[model samples]
Target: MNNVRSKICGITRVEDALAAARAGADAIGLVFYAKSPRAVNVQQARAIVQALPPFVTTVGLFVDASRCEVGEILDALPLDLLQFHGDETPAQCEGHGRPWIKALRVRPGDDLEAACQEYVGARALLLDAYVAGVPGGTGQSFDWSLIPARLSKPVVLAGGLSPDNVAEAIAQVKPWAVDVSGGVEQAKGIKDAQKIDAFLRAVRGA
Candidate 1:
């Protein structure tokens, strides 16, 4: 119930990021994909990262970006982790000078073991619902039964996770951590502090 780390994703504002940190988020995600409504550029991300207090993990989310593109951002950002939300090869996710996670859009009958093995380099595996044409932030929940009881790597359960259902999710999936974006937001790229506090409270109380 307790010690289940939480990440507030799709942060676009310094104040919102600070709110998440103040609300006890173990990590805060900064989206980098240009097409995403929650995406933040270098200047924006830099400011947000700078504003965060100690021990809050800074995650950079990228969607099938090129190595050159990732490298460029790596040079400028102070990200502690990378979440690959697209079909990036293990090698592509590697050598970015930060620990990385691989996000798999889970669907029925998908070979999660193989995928985990393939991305063996990832510190954790982020499992999100499979929504067509949407890399992430769709606020969709996947069937928890589909996830194997045990995986080679830790599972960062995502998709449609909010304070309302997260308690049930933590009981059912027992993920190493949980990630929420739209669930804690007032609008796209805008987080609600009350929602964030409620969500973290639920996580701790679950």
Candidate 2:
């Protein structure tokens, strides 16, 4: 079994996907929201997804997108999982037949347990730091104490994770997996290959 799984999100180019996969990423994310600067058109996403090597899961992220939009993207790109970053109801998240992961924007004084309870059927819960008026991809982390010791589903930690501190974060949280976007990028929508390799090596060591 993979010891410390890692996901590289917001991939926009073929080279980036290949770099992430070579760096040992367990999965890679493709942003489908048109509003996001990192967002990829259906054709672009399809090409990138097709170029990815075997054994690397592709995750499609949406922010309050309609079922039809999600379906079309899924048909276009062979994504392995769906991630809801906006305020999507459980009904909406489950409406798609594919397994889904829900993003919980961690905020001060937030009840992590209660939030996870709302999405009980989610394949996994991704805990990310809350950013006003932004649909994630923010290089900020929340307080780890907010996460409860016992959760019903797997927890995939995200937000501000980098090679510098990923080991400490994993040792403390012990999440089923960890995800990174801006942390491994040189700038928004641009990935740094060396950073990707370093981040993966750190997670592998954990």
Candidate 3:
């Protein structure tokens, strides 16, 4: 089998996006949710996307954003994929006519398998830890065992992942990809270059 891919989300700066691409991140995510401290304006995100090297995927993240909001950003910036991190239905997600990854917050006793089935046609299913009063960007990990081995779609593990434990997470869960936000950040929306390099190295080693 091939090595697990990883994404560095909540990117806010051109330097950070460059660092993430250089560090071998499969994709770099830019938050567009206005409520998020990590959110970036279209111009800022477009600059960062344009600055990246070829083949480095740029991902746009939204939290129940309106169609107009998503359309406006897509029209302005170059994005390879869209990630829906809120209570968006499959129809709403697919209506945009862009490939998308749907994030599902997993909690104890939750049926991950069934949830994946519910979001049919998603490019990938991102499994994030369930935290009270937190929508996303909470660097907390859920039980790997909570995920069933059998699923209809690809699984992308998110929540709390870092250089130290990513290898273990990969070995155990065998997810198609892993995503990190706060784990590689200097602040809520800022990414650390050293941490980004280390995290990518760890994923490669796994």
lDDT: which is higher, 1 or 3? 1
Q: Give the range where candidate 1 is weakest over 10 consecutive residues by summed lDDT.
A: 1-10
Q: Please report the candidate that would top TM-score against the real structure.
A: 1
User: What are the candidates' C-alpha RMSDs?
Assistant: 0.8, 1.4, 1.2
Local distance difference test values of all predictions, in order = 0.95, 0.90, 0.89
All candidates: TM-score: 0.98, 0.96, 0.96
lDDT score of residue 170 within candidate 1: 95
List pairs with backbone clashes in candidate 3: none
Report the C-alpha displacement of residue 70, candidate 2, in angstroms. 0.8
lDDT by residue (tens digit), candidate 3, 1-206 = 35788899999999999999988999999999888889999889988988999988888999888889889888888788999999998877887767999998898888767877788878889999998767799899989999888787899999899889988999998999999999998888888999999998888888
Model 1 deviation from native, Cα RMSD in Å: 0.8
Q: Candidate 2 — what's its lDDT? A: 0.90
The prediction achieving the highest lDDT against the true structure is: 1
Clashes of each: 0, 0, 0
Off by over 4 Å in 2: none
Model 3 error, position 136 (Å):
0.7
Candidate 3 at 163: error in angstroms? 0.6
Where's the lowest-lDDT run of ten residues in candidate 3? Answer: 112-121
Q: Candidate 3: lDDT of 32?
A: 92
Number of backbone clashes in candidate 3: 0
lDDT tens per residue, model 1, 1-206: 47899999999999999999999999999999999999999999999999999999999999999999989998998789999999888999998889999999999999998988999999999999999999999999999999999899999999999999999999999989999999999999999999999999999999
